[model samples]
Target: EDYRAKGFFKEALVNFVALLGWNAGDDREFYYLNELAEKFELERVNKAGAVFDIEKLNWLNAEHLRAKDPADLIEPLKAELNSAGIDFSGRSDEYLKSVIIAMRERVSFVKEYIEKSPYFFLPVAQYDETSKLKNWKPETGPQMLRLKEEFAKLGENPSKEEYEVALKLVATELNIGAGKLIHPLRLAVSGMPAGPGVYDILVILGKEETINRIEKAVSIL
Candidate 1:
């Protein structure tokens, strides 16, 4: 129960424990429950005591998560989000699917989707201190305000490329590298040092939300 709460799927847990005392005589580490039933052999059991390796279980859990379709993860993820008191109201299943696609590789557990990137479900409560120091600058407020104007120019349902082009135009107009705007923009929207591509985050958040977060950052940070 504890492991499931921590995002270990039942299949992953069963697969990991099965290998602790036996092998199928190959390099394969992943197996479905049915596969395990077919492959288990008495002669393959190890003579030495098996160690409970939590790290290996974590890896297997991640593998299982990656193997699943993003849509398949939505209900379980929603349950976890509700348990954690995350309000995903007004967000669609497609929106959640985009988040899963973006964050799946970055997280090993289901709960980590909300834990590592709370900005997805809620507004930026606090900015990352280290990110603020590195990405936000004294002149960043005015620069972000200018960037916000460019974002405001975008139509509804803008593409990732549109966001990228807008940022590049802002950088060119300021006579600075895009990184100047990119780093600060990422800090403004995600409140994290890193995650997915900045443009991807912008696209997922949509034009209004993206511009709003920038305005908030400019005012506060």
Candidate 2:
């Protein structure tokens, strides 16, 4: 932020990508780095930052993440984690897909998963119990149990509005504010205090995966 606060834009731009994700390889350096020598276009570089408007970046990152085969991103994601002594051993790419979906909101550069997210993605890693405790609650536990049953019935590609409607229903049944269901629900899915609206995450993850994560959350709680 300091270089950015100064007018060293090129340096700052180099630093900005470093702020969130990992560079996959030296083969491609155009988007935010070294490409200036041949491919740098002023139109491409913004003098001002978007300031982590995760909604915009989440959609963009998901587009990029989804466009690539799950295998491509998964191996890199696993390799990055393993180098740090994190584990993806024996965990299926299916779970990794859900982790990517869960974190799409919490990350900007997208590869932030390799660095910013270890607790949620890796196996048998130690984490801050206090942080996890911040979002888990007794009522939230039962709420998720019920949510699991509800979401378990959805099809492969349910819409966001479908999940929203289901959430509103869950809110009503629980006799609590949607904020209660949504906030805790989001925390449970992403293992973070904040993220994309919970409904959107559910929609992207599809129905079955959503239910599976909710079931996992209930068990953890």
| Weakest ten-residue segment in model 1 by summed lDDT | 2-11
- Taking all chains together, the TM-score of candidate 1 against the true structure is 0.96
User: Best candidate per TM-score, number?
Assistant: 1
* RMSD to native, candidate 1: 1.2
Off by over 4 Å in 2: 1-111, 118-135
In model 2, the number of clashes is 0
True lDDT of residue 140, candidate 1: 93
**Where does candidate 1 clash, by residue pair?**
none
In order, the Cα lDDT scores of the candidates are 0.91, 0.59
TM-score of each: 0.96, 0.51
The TM-score, computed over Cα atoms with residue i paired to residue i, of candidate 2 is: 0.51
